[model samples]
Target: MIKVLIVDDIPETRNHLTKLLSVDSEIDVAGTAGSGEEAIRVAMELRPDVIVMDINMPGMDGVAAAEIVSQRLPTSPIIMMSVHGEAEQLRRAIAAGAREFLVKPFSADEFSTTIKRVYERELGRREQLQAITPAPSGPQEPGSAEEDHQVVAVFSPKGGAGRTTIAANLALALMSETGGRVCLVDANLQFGDVGVLLNLNPKNRSILDAIEGGEPDADLLESVVVDHSTGIRVLLAPPSPEGADLVTPTYLRKIIDLLRVTHDWVVVDLPPALTDHTLGIMDAADQIVVLSALEITTIKNVRLFLEVADQLEYDRSKLRLVINRSDTAQGIRISDVEASIRRPVDGTVVSDGRLAVLAVNRGVPFVVSHPEAALSRDITRLARTLAGEPSTSASTEKPKKGLFARR
Candidate 1:
């Protein structure tokens, strides 16, 4: 039987996961822990084949524990769990050697499938390792670092344009292509929803750590990431709402630059309102995904945003306009939408309320939940297009870069 350890600060979550795994005939729950400290002790003693860890824990967080466990037990695979949308945490988790990640409130089927996949992948790696006889056992130096990493920022001047949603799904889509490292940051600092969108617990060491310059070590990043089903990693917002202001624009750039060195793609979800931090992100971004819906207010905001970008002297080529929830039923034509924005719409993502609602409610990315769905397909195409491939797609229009007055 496959042995597993469940780690979460909350008893209910641990109990629920335990009960769910209990029904599996081939799996055994070797142990469980409520804190990061206890988890380390239990994990070392149990030495289970797999660990299901929650990123948010009191005193010692899950990422910290995973770092220790991965080093001590490189043979074992860790599957991280969380509800926040901070990108730093997700990148940190993968760096710590986690094999897979499961979002919170995951269905029984998702949970089981992930567990199975993790085991299979780990087992597969071991098989491959065994085939190579008598290889030198010293530390493997420079296991292929991610290079030419591009910074993509999803920003909107107006609220409710689905910038966060686009950034989240697009990051997952990028993962599908390269299987390289991807990081999504909820730079909406003050009112970020990347965490809520993924349903990760509020306690992530993302924006707070980046702002404070705490845990600057490369290994510390893994200790804070929440893993999603699609293998996309996330760094969630602060555990508390009040902690947002602590992050400044310089810190945001520093954090993004730090990630660029390690990650193949760094996607940031910026605040609807332009702050100093937003401008910093815009200046650093290799590509700017501007999201807007087909509404009068959204169009007007896009125009104003464009004006701001012009004022800031941001490159127009880097700005890619995306129209979210584009529907003819809304009495808006693509022609009129383009006429309003003056720039050609790079891509459009059709509205699928059913799919989107289900994805957000489950704290999962729609791209993973319904990869074959219309939205998911479009997202994949968009991902390719962002990577410099072409795709004839349809959605809303938003300005690229900050085209608004500097605050």
Candidate 2:
């Protein structure tokens, strides 16, 4: 429930506001203060989630009190209320660190929503601050006996290039191939869908939880990672977009390092753009699986990404270009695409829109659910190549119904 403290000099106004908030089942009135001075005292004592302070108080006005309260407890959001809807008053409230302002005679729904918004906003700010703060040093945990663990990052320069799908399926394939020692990280902090794709709840247990306690240990990481039915361990993204800012680049590095020590393979699903956090992950990855589709726009973005990678001094050998939906009859052949991008396609996932959509809707990896499908075979081959394992003898033979066979 949202804990709220009502502050108003008028006794009747305080009771009315408290009654209004009480109607909402999600909100609880922690306490009430008669004046701004009393409000600061009560806030310091209770540290309510939200403060509804009335402006134009007798002694200390709302603006002055809000500034002091904000300084004292930066995480608690303040909602300033006034009878006059003057621009100057709004400016003063904002300058004093009030998260929201309400003119008197507002409806209960509006009041409740404003409080909730401010509270959520404050929580996000707190999480971001915690993320940037250096974690406390802890005793180093023992590393895994296996020393050949690889960190593979799946990246796309544009959205809807099927990067997450590939990352999820690849991780599942690795888990099967490696005997259940794979970890998949949803690194697209702001709007990651790895959990949804895999059908994991991702609530409370996320990458944010792993790093929120400061220094990450193997135990912490293990506790936060959720197990997928496909036998892959997953570190999910934050439950809300507001919490994305909480996972800082420094925290991510520490988490990945810890994960590498615990899991045989760590597969990260990256966001479309190149942010500082994404760049850090790419720098640490043993292989960068760059994904592209048959669309001209996506291919162009991929080419640009390759150029940027070169400028960043990334080893060309570490980059693997995969064309998703390689069998699309868009009048563009794989050879033509290779020539256009000036690079050989390392892998191709055949397009089967119906099967792909069904797999996603069922929250099952395409390879696991439809092992006989052409898309599954392609992903399996790609996984094998990434794991540095040579393909089997059967893999050498051409498929009788190859999806990418030339017409």
Candidate 3:
């Protein structure tokens, strides 16, 4: 059950809110506080799962108290309560570490839903982190940097087809299943957001520096990677936007070769525009996932990219299509998508705006925050499929049982 603390100076409001929340079986009102100071004391003492705090309490305002409570107990999610949903107050509440906002007139359903989401998000995060880090096999290659990793680059010819999201969630899924060393490289240097989405510190170390300083070995390259709470490592792009273009194809090739020797899986998120670096990454990839949407423009681009890959003698067998945002509500059907691309979409992510927005805004992966979501489930399945785990069903024209089909 989610332990909630109702923090408000007004007794009537506090009792009403507590009674409203008590109706939900999953929620438990730990206690009530009439002042911000009292709320802080309760939060520190009781360590509730969530705090429904009022904005205008005496001694300390809700925002200030939230900031203190949040610091004291970083694990608990704060939900700010306000008389009005004023834009400025809401902004302040968020900045003060409030995960969500509830207006004074919020219905029981609204309050309950927000509380449940916050609770689930936290619980899911803990589970995901636990899922990723397992015992190492033998000992890590000590001073043996070359024997450690496999770098897989994910590239597509088109943009707005969910490349970064794919790379981020795929990394999570891979790490969760394999419990091995997995690193995601945000090679889309200009607009790289893998770090931001994953809540990583944008450290100075990046692929650019490694490349510029000549082909560095695994020992030197290890300094650049940032390890997430979920155990996936990442080498972020440079903070400056203009710096991306400076990286040459030769530079990327060297980085991939080095990574392949060191990490278990090196997933790179290539930019939409095919530069020399993109081609080099594709050449080095064990698997290349081409992300496309069910749009005419994206389909046309996919066809063009396939032709280019054929001309360039890239592995057609390894190239796979992934259709993102595949909602039946959309006009574009799956048949139309396959007919245009001349290939079956490897997988489809279901429409989930709530999960997507929350994950992005909170800098957490959806698979980690809301694993039960359709998008998360599909992404996890895709990851398992890529890891050489056979699917239960096969795509043969004649029905055939896959390796793991029920017998």
lDDT of 3 by residue, 1-407 (tens): 88999999999999999889878999999899999889889898999998899998877899988877765566788999898999999998887778899887989999999999998897886665675545543223355444334455676667767888889999888777666567888888787888678755433567666655666557667766666656677888877789877776666666767666666677889898765667667766767788877777887888888877676555555676778888843588988978877777777777777888899898888988778788999988888767763221111112222212312
lDDT of 2: 0.80
lDDT by residue for model 2 (271-349), tens: 9987777777777777899998888888889898898878665677788999999988488788877888898999999
Which stretch of 10 consecutive residues in model 1 shows the poorest summed lDDT?
Answer: 390-399
lDDT of 3: 0.75
On TM-score, the candidate that comes out on top is: 1
Model 3 scores worst on lDDT over the 10 consecutive residues at: 391-400
The C-alpha stretches of model 3 lying farther than 4 A from their native spots are 1-128, 132-149, 389-407
| TM-score, model 3 to reference | 0.63
Off by over 4 Å in 1: 4-36, 44-47, 50-147, 202-204, 213-219, 389-407
**Cα lDDT for residue 216, candidate 3:** 55
Residue lDDT tens for model 1, 52-136: 9998888888888887777556667999998864678788787666777666678887887788889888888666434321232
Candidate 3 residue-wise lDDT at 403: 17
TM-scores, all models, native as reference = 0.67, 0.60, 0.63
Candidate 2 vs candidate 3: the TM-score winner is 3
User: How many residue pairs clash per model?
Assistant: 34, 0, 8
In order, the Cα lDDT scores of the candidates are: 0.75, 0.80, 0.75
